[model samples]
Target: MLTKQDVHVLRTLLQEYAHAASLPVNQEKQRLWIKLNHLHMERPMVLIDQIPWNEMDVDGSLRCLVADTYWRQVEDNLRCTLYKFRHMPADMVLNPYVCLPRPIHNSGWGIEPVSSRHIELEMGSTAPSREFVNQIQSLDDVERIKIPQLTLDEKREAQIIQEADEIFSGIIDYRLTGLCMHLGIWDSIAMWMGVENCYFALMDEPEMIHALLEKMTEGLIDMIGQMNRQKLFDIHSHVCHCSQTFLEDMPKENDLPLSGNAWAFGLAQLFTSVSPAITDEFEVQYMKRVFPYFGAIYYGCCDRLDDRMHVIEKLPKIRKLSCSPWSEREHFAQVMPRYCVMSNKPNPAFLASGKLDEQLIRDDIRRTIDAAKAHNRNLELILKDISTVNHNPSCLWRWQEIAMEEVQR
Candidate 1:
């Protein structure tokens, strides 16, 4: 089922990544190559000789070009990795497009203008489940989209984030970073109505919550479909991005687990900044309606995950899951076991904490290994954003020890 052109594209991509892996021009590129190599070694069967990878242009001029370039390389390598896992020898990778919240990335949440009346009315709408209906509706009624009125700082804040985001457009995978897009209506609702009000509305006014999710999810699905057609959905490679924990707490009316549509179900669980209670609610109710649209589910993102792990055990279509810094390592090792592959990330504290010694970091990895062993031996270590590491490359070596030690055991 492989074609010469497809295979050639992949080989070129792999070679580029291989080159980038050794040559680190900047911090972002270095991280990208290192991560690619880690994946290649951890899942050699899926990445090394099995799947096809291709290189492409890294868009965005304002951000770190090196990081963007390196990610492009990794994206190509991951294509091959995904192909081997899916048993599709030459198919291009089609992942979901995730728009996450702001808080997950340590970027504080800000208020976006929205209409309570319009949102309330949309909640009771009887429209078909077509995607982007809200956008269409919003466009049709621009007046409804008007903000109640924001303070000067709110406007400036929103603008600042927008400008800064453009700079790091492709560098930070915000979709996976925070779970969902920051500019969407529900996001506005959360910031404007306050999480407490919006949450209570989920139960007190079911129609309102239903309308909000339907509208928001529709926009997301449309975006994903467009990206899929354009072959740009690989940006947010992970399905659940940052929403796995939030899905657990979603109201029974909202929890939507992935349905088995090989193409559509490939990605689910993209909500972010969501709590355990909300994650369950969405998993039990809402996601049920939407899950059939993806091929697989990638769960977990930046979340307060202590309460969410128990719920992950029940998701039926999940093929891969991310292990957040906050999640209990042993819990994942005990729960999903072989059903899912775990991406283990050492907390920022470990790398950012000025106390950078092998013993301290080694203890942390030792604990992680001891915990993951209870489930299965599979694991991948991810050394994410370490501003401090920028000054001290030696700290990275400790990470190598941690990973290698775990493998040796």
Candidate 2:
């Protein structure tokens, strides 16, 4: 049961969402995004994310006003969506629909970190100092990692959607979005065994590392099958892994459900110092187990992946290549194939500093633009990993202004 206040707040947010969805710009954006993803863009597209969103403003514009805990999350999402478009509106598309997770929950991998310590420089930082008590220290320890059992609440799922439709009828649609995966086989393993423990094992205990990854990879592949079997894969989902999915080529007539339309995101953040040969042997090899199940794949993250593009580009169904702040612009731009979109991530540290250094932002974006032009490759600016903006949200507005100008040029 919603309180009068909850009803008022939700209704107000829905009104704005409906109005925004009706705007002509969304249709225009959807078309451009499709062209960009197809690697045939007339110009570049720009977007910003990975924000410390909750702390963007002290003015309470970013504050959660709803009383219910669950509803508060809905309120937060709505506020951020409106705040984002109102401020930047840089190539972001809004729909009259909001996607909700399917009513599916799971019992996680049975093993837990035995011991760990961590400290953060600031609240809400995604990175922090950490240590772990290596849980998988030997060959036998691989058995301790268990596959999570999944449960679907179909009755509850129907109930919630029906209720949402009843509340927001004719105003907005509440659609259910299903699971798309980012293969984090290595990330989970690194935490169970310490990060250094895993890396050292690559050299010191290569056999043990291989045994662990194989077991972990098998479990994840199995999980994907189970999720698909439950009819929980949503390929047309608007947002995927912090980026947008523009094309909607769903499974044709009898095509395999996920195999025809689904996507898999692949990355190994710990491969910073590892060589291309070792990365292929460990990360890429295991990831290939599930690659055939998806029609396309987006690969890489914050860790420097430029040096090893030759290795990953050969992986099956490679679509988008993430160009991180550390990736060499000219080389990656030149070498990245025309079939894939180079998603260049600008350094958010420029925005994180005590004050905005406008010149640094210009230089970074200009370098990316130049690199893309030099190679005649299509590039998209995805400014992310933004942990802070010194409590001044206006910096993002400025960034949008600067980046939009550069990309359009």
Candidate 3:
């Protein structure tokens, strides 16, 4: 449902990729096309507020040697705008998904390095120390001298074929760009398994947290079967970002095909800073066993959005369900009238204070288009970036002309 010259040729190719990211050899393809150009489109909701939050380390026990030189200057300004967006072809821009290498999950899994010099060598240790989980189970680039290529199993199978070639190159650019292909790379493997070992590990030890989340979901299905053996891999779009931590029934039926991926899923609920009855006992029982491995699914991400609106009112083939910025815009316009497509984020300190206060950003874009035009459906507002906010890019080209005049009146 995106007409109007396909949102004016995606707001003129995201304002000529944000004016070629303030030039300088297209600053790493304008910071990975301004944070993965809304996952190269197909209703991949983005509002824009610039958020890196010191490259998030929710519990990997910080100390990325002074934040890996500002995350390699935002991955050399996103591989200089993906080598000037011929969608990455300048000698495959060092393709390992452009920039890949990671580890530091309790020092690549043996657990217990909660840092600050392992809390001053476990100060008054009482237990929970087999030499502090065997010195955070395996970290050797000379005892974890800040996790550079310690070859965590061949750089996690080349970062799962560089995140399955960004969802098989966005389903081959959504069949030559019809649009709606926003892949987030399964929350970048849940930020390399450190959202508290991907959510509390069955409250810490349900058979050693289901044998380390089933050997990290069988090394994420052998890095998504080497990202479905690269070359053009099938294209079905509809994958969003963040959310996952299951536990309740703890996947038994032959661990639901190694926990998810048929294609199409989305969730946001950033573990609501824990405790909404432990985010409904481990984020709604491991996302109801990864919701039928998806056709489409979504839940909140930024603010609890009424604690995952009762698991987005039981998502089956969810089409889009965020309301966040701490939802309740008239109870998400009366509970997302007719199950799905709401989005509506708006609030990265009101688009990062570069104050052009066009009557307070056109009265918050006319109260989010009169609250999603009386909730018939489909709204879309998202200006994210919750931590270390910083981006403005003329408030993402003036909120794409105030979200195309509130999704066309």
RMSD of each: 16.0, 2.2, 22.7
lDDT of each: 0.40, 0.78, 0.41
Q: Estimate each model's TM-score.
A: 0.47, 0.93, 0.25
Quote the positional error of residue 368 for candidate 3 in Å. 2.4
- Across 112-229, the per-residue lDDT of candidate 3 in tens digits comes to 2332213322333221222111222222211332221112344644554444344334222212101111232224334434455545543654454344334444443344343333
User: Residue by residue across 1-409, what tens digits does model 1's lDDT show?
Assistant: 2234433443444443333333333233223323332332232111112100111112321121123332434344344333332332111222222232222112222223334333212332322122111221222222233222111234543643554354334433223221222223344444445455555655676565555555555554554444334233222333233211112122133222222222222212233445656666654345444444445555454443435666555655554456667667776566653655566666756654434767877777778766765554455555443334333433444455455555455
lDDT of 3 at 206: 47
Off by over 4 Å in 1: 1-207, 224-232, 235-277, 304-306, 313-316, 385-393
Better of 1 and 3 by TM-score: 1
Kindly report which residue pairs in candidate 2 clash with one another. none
Model 2 residue 253 distance off true place after TM-score fit, in angstroms: 11
